[model samples]
Target chain A: MIQVEGLTKYYGALAAIRDLTFAIDRGEVIGFLGLNGAGKSTALRVLGCVLLPTSGRVTIDGFDVVRDPHEIRKRIGFLPDTPPLYTEMTVGAYLEFVARLRGVPSGRAKARTIEVEERTATRDVHDEVIGNLSHGFKQRIGIAQALVHNPKLLILDEPTSGLDPVQIVEMRQLIKGLKGEHTILLSSHILSEISQTCDRLLVIQGGEIVGQGSEQELATQMGSGGYLEIEIGGPSQGEGRAPVEKALQAVRAVAGVLSASVIREEAHVAQIKLDAPAALCPQVVRALVAADIDVMRVGRGSAQLESIFLKLTQTGGQPS
Target chain B: MSATFLIARRELGAYLRSMIGWVIIAGVLAVDGLLFNAFALGGGDKRSSEVLSLFFYFSSGTTMIASVLIAFRLLAEERQTGTINLLYSSPIRDGEIVLGKFLSALAFLAIVTLATGFMPMLVMIHGKVSYGHVAGGYFGLLLLGSATLAIGTFGSALTRSQVLAAILSACMVVAMLVAWLLGRITERPLSEVFSNLSLHGLHFQPFQAGIVHLRDVVYYLAVTYVALFAATRVLEARRWR
Candidate 1:
């Protein structure tokens, strides 16, 4: 568990994060979503005890970060925006060194290293020099070092940053695999990145947390309402596209259906974006299936977080 | 203390595994050997003690230079590579981190200094050499290296780039090296003050001549203390920045 209240950090006259308050429960996987300079890294650094907050209180499990940082450091593992690594060291030696530094007993250091290497799937490259490894491997080694100590919480800043698509998928899967063990709070700019791995999200903007919830909960609470995106395959065999349109129009005529627009048109699939009140999602999905339209995908709209995030940060005068 | 030694042991291994360690050792020994042959034994029949004294004289310069070179990368490289975050986020105290780095550099400098012992033995064999004199001279070399390395450690802590670290350390060493000349130009009390402040003038001369005064030992220890203390404070203040 973690508790942070009014945690404000100032870099000279500029306040990086101000009046931030949040508490994380044990075993919760939370995503920290923010635009650039949104104070995510600053907040994470304060929580990790790597940077001191100028004014506020932060405690991990019961130990105050400012007064008892060393004790807090024993309970949390931190990976900064850029994976801090020693290029000269091999992956195995580096992880083992971190394990010992985090107070793992020498007798159990190797076992702990092996445990984390396997957990992060870095065992195959254990003997390779960190400098020689690819970016993905180096990033994995960075996470491995943090996990090797087996701390209570993991604070990863931009975990999938700068990786190619494949590497990003691998890193996301690796983090997902770690969900149940550690209280993970990861930060990223990509929505899909957070949506796939995190159970809930805390969207930050301009040093303040604007929205916090699961995808649907946030869309519902923001009051801009949620939209259902249904991608249907080509027109039905004998029935024309009018049935699909009439069915959609009929669904819109249903109580919470506000409006709909076509977003994308691939060869066989047509993507539709809905702007609707929060209550009409189920009726819309049911109407499509009842009309015998082959739905390739039934999911939420893509710009749900973007709209909510921009409203919070780009507001004229929003405070924490 | 356990954390201090744990960090120190790893740092020492880093030095041994890297090419820079062997470069300093090879460079210093090769220069020492060449100087020993060119100056100490090149001329005619000199007293064994004088030849041994010359060997110590040339070795002192190289040892001081080597100390600066070896200590330049201690903290600066970590900052450059962003690896200092590991130490910053770890449970170890700031003072422990500094002592760990200082101890590692001192250990490697000791190895390099000892590698040239064969030249001293050669001086002893052909001439009438006192074992105590050689011991005293080597002691002086080590103490000088330790003081220079400590100063270099403080310099390295001030900057993030290795080039800037070396420049700062060289300037600090040169200022102290020139203090003796300043002492020569000034009046009595001020001259005496500069003389004592000169890193090698008053303190190192006694050890160079086969005598180990407690005052000289105390001065080196004091410099080491002040420099390492300053470096630790610098590391701690960085988190705030």
Candidate 2:
């Protein structure tokens, strides 16, 4: 539903975003991942038709952003990092106003407002003034306004930025529910917050797209292999270092095991790290058990994606 | 045009609901009444025509200042509060946003300006003043208010700070008000140019004297149109920045 080529934006002599190229298919939820000042907002603003790119072309649903921004505006709903809300207006009235502003006929504006309010779970506060609502409700109102007109695409910049943990979970579910009805593009600095909610991830750093793919695809591409974390207890007490050394050697001998090391040793228990695909984890565990190392726990490491993200961003996706 | 009216209606509703709008109306009316009692009606004996003219004269100052205050928040406050993104991302044109804001302020200013009609009616009650004179004076105030409000809209478009918008608008209005003074110092052709450019000195005198000139009407409208156009351009330029 969206395609961008060489999208560059410059404020005076400094470039905010440079040479950004990506395409988003219909019915897909894409997460734009970047740290603060990583040009994520600038890129999204350009795509939202709020700012014009200094160079490059962007088209949404076959309409050019620069030449046909009005057409694009009618088809896309955008919620900026700070929700564009009129504090004096009631939630219902504000949603109705936004509905009409985006070309929803006046006759149907109220119905559309109610529909969006229901979707965003803001129905109870329909009559409440926005300024009086809590931050979580205010964010929901922001999402409601974006979808009030039922646009083809939704551009949300950091939808969960200031929310508390419970609010964040609610927001995640709300966004997840929005999938299939509209193509969603949301940005976030926190990987775990958006990783599960999005179908694909676009990692950006220094105004450039360093990597793009699903979580596992990005992990496999950046990480030589998945990591395996294993915890084992020795048969006898105070045999700590000997059992850890024996388990590490046995795990390394297994085929497809790239490397192995003892992570930590305490009493008779030792934690070992193995650089091998998760599919070979069973074999590593078997080798450790056959070596008389009592297996307490065996599972895929959780830092696989985290390591990939840090590696891609720090190295700019260059070969290590 | 519907988009323009949609924005205008919302903005006007905002003005009606907020305390600042009512405060401006009350403050301007109080100041207008005080000036009428102290200056227009108080100073010794004078003809009814002179009194009405003086009323228009003082009311013009209040209208100009009130226009600046009313319009300073039109666009600047939207930017300050970050609500401008709603308008910016909508399908509406830049001209529509500018015109919608200007129209709302103009409507509010007209209501406040007309509310001071009792002062003119007081002159009509005691002495003999032509209805034409009242209408002419009011027409001039409206036109002057419209033009200054447009200038204020342009100023508001230039920055996100309402105080800065007010200052910028005051500077523009004062410059045009003092053009006649500038004309007095310069020679011949330059003086004529400056005199013709004056916002109030020459253009408003005919309306103040109970005579509506086509040229004066056109000049006020021309100023309104040009300022509104510049404000629209400023809004459009923001997208590029």
Candidate 3:
């Protein structure tokens, strides 16, 4: 549904986004992942038809952004990082206005508004003035406006920004529900949220795309073969460390194990980090049990998306 | 055109709903009334034509000032509050956005200007004032208001700060208003050009004196058109920025 090539935007001498090339297929939800100032908003704005790229080309649904912006605008609904809301208007009125603005017929605008409000779960606040709504409701109103005209693509800059945990979860569910109807490209600095929601992610840093793929693909690309973290209870006394060491060695010998290391050792338990394909986890666990190491707990490690994001952005760089 | 009217309707609705719009209307009307009573009516007995001319003179000043105040928020406030993205991302043309905003402010300013009609009617009651004079004076006021609002819309498009928009527009209007003085200092053909180009000097004097000149009407409309076109260009340029 979208294709961008060499999309560079410069605010004077500073380049906001440089050489950004990507394509999004129809019905796919793509997450733009970057830290603050990583040029995520600039890229999204270009794709949204809100800003023109300094150089390069963008097309949405076969229409050029620079040459056919009006056509593209009619097909795409963009929600900027800050929701473009008229606070003085009621939620229903605001949605209706947006619906018509995006080319929905006036006769159908109210019906479209109600449909979007229902989809975004903003039906109860239909008559409430937008200024009086809570932030969560306000964000929902933003989503409602975007969907009111039922465009082919939805570009949301940061849909979960500034929401509490519950609101974030609700928003995630809301976006997840929107998957099949429209092509969605949402940007966020929140790793877990993007991971949980998007089919694929574009990791950006310093105005450049550093990585792009599904979560497991990125993890494999980052050289960690999708790891397993295991916590085992074993003798940690003077001579007791020997059994734990033997268990670790035995687990390392499992068929798909690339490497293994003891993460930390406690008096009665030891946490081990294993570098291996996730499918080999069961074999590693069986090996540990056969060696008389008591397996306390086992799960996928934190080094999945987080480590890949950190590696791509580097540790100290802030998200743009 | 439908997009233009849709935006205009929403903007006019905003003006009607907001306290600032009412404040501007009340303030301009009160000031117009005070000037009419203290100066036009109270300076001593005079011919009704002179009184009506003085009323137009004072009302023109209020109209110009009020136009700046009304239009300063048209685009600048949208940019300030970030609501401009709705217009920018929509399928509407940039010219439509500028025209819609200018028309809404023009409509509001017209209402405020019309509210001061009682002052003219007062002159009509006590003395003899021609209906043509009243109509001519109001037509001039509307034209002057339209021109200034367009200039202010251009200024609003140039910045996100409403204060800066007001200042920029006021500066443009003041420069045009003072062109006649500039003409007075310069010599011959240049002086004629500057005086003729002055926004209120020769152009509005005919309307103030109860005569509607075609050239004056065309000049105001031209100014309105040029300013609105510039505002549209500025809106288009913002996408590049």
- Please, what is the whole-model Cα lDDT of each candidate in the order they appear? 0.85, 0.92, 0.91
Error of 1 at B212 (Å): 0.7
lDDT of 2 by residue, A68-187 (tens): 999999999999999999999999999999999899999999999999888888999999999899999998999999899898999999999999999999999999998999999999
Against the true structure, what is each candidate's TM-score?
0.89, 0.93, 0.93
DockQ metric for all predictions = 0.57, 0.76, 0.81
| Residues B147-227 of candidate 1: C-alpha lDDT, one tens digit per residue | 899999999999999999999999999899889899999999999988888888788877766788989988888888988
lDDT of 2 by residue, B1-241 (tens): 9899989999998998899899999999999999999998887999999999999998999999999999999999999988898899999999999999999999999889999999999999999999999999899999999999999999999999999999999999999999999899999999999998999999999989889999999999999999999999999999998
Question: lDDT tens digits, residues A1-320, model 1?
Answer: 99989999899999998888888999999999988898999999888888888998898989998899899889889998878887878888888889999899999999999999998888898898888998888888889888888999999999898899999999998998888989999999888889889989988878988778887667666655776777877554565566557546756666777687777755566777777754666787777777776667777653366666666566622422
Clash pairs, model 1 backbone: none
Off by over 4 Å in 1: A228-274, A277-279, A282-303, A310-313, A316-320
How would you order the candidates by DockQ, starting with the best?
3, 2, 1
Worst 10 residues of 1 chain A by lDDT: A311-320
TM-score of 2: 0.93
Q: Chain B TM-score for each model?
A: 0.97, 0.98, 0.98
Q: A-chain TM-score in candidate 3?
A: 0.86
Ranking by lDDT: 2, 3, 1
